[model samples]
Target: MKTDQEIMQNIRTAIDDCTKGIDDAPSLQYQIARKAKGEEPVVKKISTTIVLVAALLAITAVAFAATNGIGITAFLSRIIGGWNVNENAIVAPVVKENTSKWLNLTGTEAYWAEDGLSVVLKVDSADDEHVVCYSNEDGLLDETGERGEQIAINGEMAPLDQWRGEKELIIAEFSPLGEGWNWYKRTDDGLFVIVTFSTPDAEALQKGTDVAFQIQDTNIQTGETEECSVTLALPAMTMQEGHK
Candidate 1:
């Protein structure tokens, strides 16, 4: 696996070799690259078309590393320890959303790598009353601060009446259940989440795969649980159409 520095250096070396053939003065950026050249090689005159093609590689190596403000990058940083749009990574803009009761789940981006598949989600509702929780015991506590219930929420073990700050919460951990889903960010309209799954099917997902997970909401008092199975059909992404 090549680091971003390695990638940039390789591209610059290729660009330097390309400039030697051009009759025209190389751009200032390319000029700087030439000074770092190692042993002198045979200089053969080449067409400007080849130089432009080499420049494209330089753009892809450097520009794609920055995601600007993307939720997918946030999740990736946790796994990789930093921001990196590596050669093996695929970041594609996608819209695959579903709604269950008042809870609306939207898939904004798709990230595929060797480990598994993950989708960046935006979870919202018609109102602000519910908090995210898992049904399992090791997860969030029940509304009454006990361990038995179908509906879930971040009860904070204080019971229903005392619950506060529901708006600013974003789920950090994914479910341990089959095909787990994930974290979010506070948004004016709603929250952004990244649903991740652990599977050995990276090869299959990269070719396009269908994924589904449970997303539910609970009415704290009524205990009425509206659970929906959200399905995401991430499109097939190739090397040429990736990292943007």
Candidate 2:
């Protein structure tokens, strides 16, 4: 039986040979080295060849695991260490927020990449019968159905149909990922809204930038609308390179 040193050497050689010519080989090598150093005692009784096979299998397993919903970019992020991937996008840390009587901001997340900027806001409302509406420009309909508008980023107009549109800025109802789900849960006090925004020029709404949202809180049962404007500070973002 080969000594531990020899076994480790063989494992290193096998990993080097297998990862040779790979673009992310350097990162893989570093991770393998770190793993091997920490696992020396655990593999002490194992044969050199078995160790080599196990290491190779580990690499394969990682690649395979990424295919099961977790993206390759996220897998690499975990191995190389840098960003956090959510829904195939590298997201920044959650930003703290303040609360208002109508809209209570819970949490915020933002991601900047070559594709564009993605922002997700978790919000709560106290009005059980209220419907939240958004507009990019002034002249939004007030509670009495009077048309009014608000200032928007870059003079862009909010999509006519907040739920479906190709507009630059869109604020839609949040639906959790899954199948067969209609109607969001309604509590005694309020409801939760997951607002997502995707825009090519997301950089405009940088940290400390206050974005004015023209919101109409309408009572669904009575058609009564309470129009209000809320300015939310864009949370700090964790910018990362775009993934192909």
Candidate 3:
């Protein structure tokens, strides 16, 4: 293949010689001879009329779609990530909220304590579920305290390492079963933070927990000091009987 320099030289000669009269016809023919010699001539100019017509058509199409609120931008994003977001997929908004409610100490209680990490919550019903959500630099680190990739939430594929270099957060929704805790982390900030809730059946609960985190709006500021309550539903079997 000819390098860029050789191609430009040929084009320059062809254009410069295009103005030559019949007296220079032989030279003009010689300039473009390289094109037949396996050197692809460069195209510097396209028909402006055709380009303008196409541009106008595109503008009209986009304007029509905008007026009707029909677009493929979101659908395209999901398909690229191996996600099939149903046109009717349910979307639950993750709102930053604050609640004064507390778990009743006397209610069924499940304690999560593994060596140094411990968390406690009272179990009453699915309504008693709570998810502890906070973003920290250490969040990027695995339970072993070593840096690790974030897990999936709702069967979403693994995130490209390139996109996970920043701060991350997960919402650990603890149910009554209380033994093995499963959690989902939202990689992207948005109104509908997709998740796969645990089911009562063993098979359903055992479905490896995690999903892809889609970025919604990173503009959702953190550390605002405005605490919020998040509700997560879970199956009763997820909680196990434990000491009070």
Which pairs clash in the backbone of model 1? 184-192
> What global local distance difference test value does model 3 have?
0.31
> Candidate 2: TM-score?
0.32
TM-score of each: 0.46, 0.32, 0.22
A best-first ranking of the candidates according to their TM-score comes to 1, 2, 3
Decide which is better by lDDT, 2 or 3: 2
lDDT of 3 by residue, 1-244 (tens): 9999999999989987886676645565664776677575755667997687556645655554466453433222222222222223212222222142322111111111111111112211112232223222212433343444543433354542433334333322333232332222233431111122223234432332211111111111132122224433222213222211
Residue-by-residue lDDT tens digits, candidate 2, 1-244:
9999999999999998987778553555665676788953333467887677557655854765566654333233232212234444434334333323455544334445544444434444444533343331122444445543342222355433351232222222332222111122122222223233334334554443443333444433345445454444554454456433
lDDT winner, 1 or 3: 1
Question: How well is each residue in 1-244 modelled by candidate 1, as lDDT tens digits?
Answer: 9999999999999998887767575555664456557434446668997676556644543455454443433343233212234544545534444546556565666665433455666555545765543233422455563543232232233442333344422122334236554554433333456666756255666587677666655554355656556677766754322222
Weakest 10 consecutive residues of candidate 3 by summed lDDT: 107-116
Candidate 1: minimum summed lDDT over ten consecutive residues — where? 168-177
Clashes of 2: 8
Error of 1 at 38 (Å): 61
Top-scoring candidate (lDDT):
1
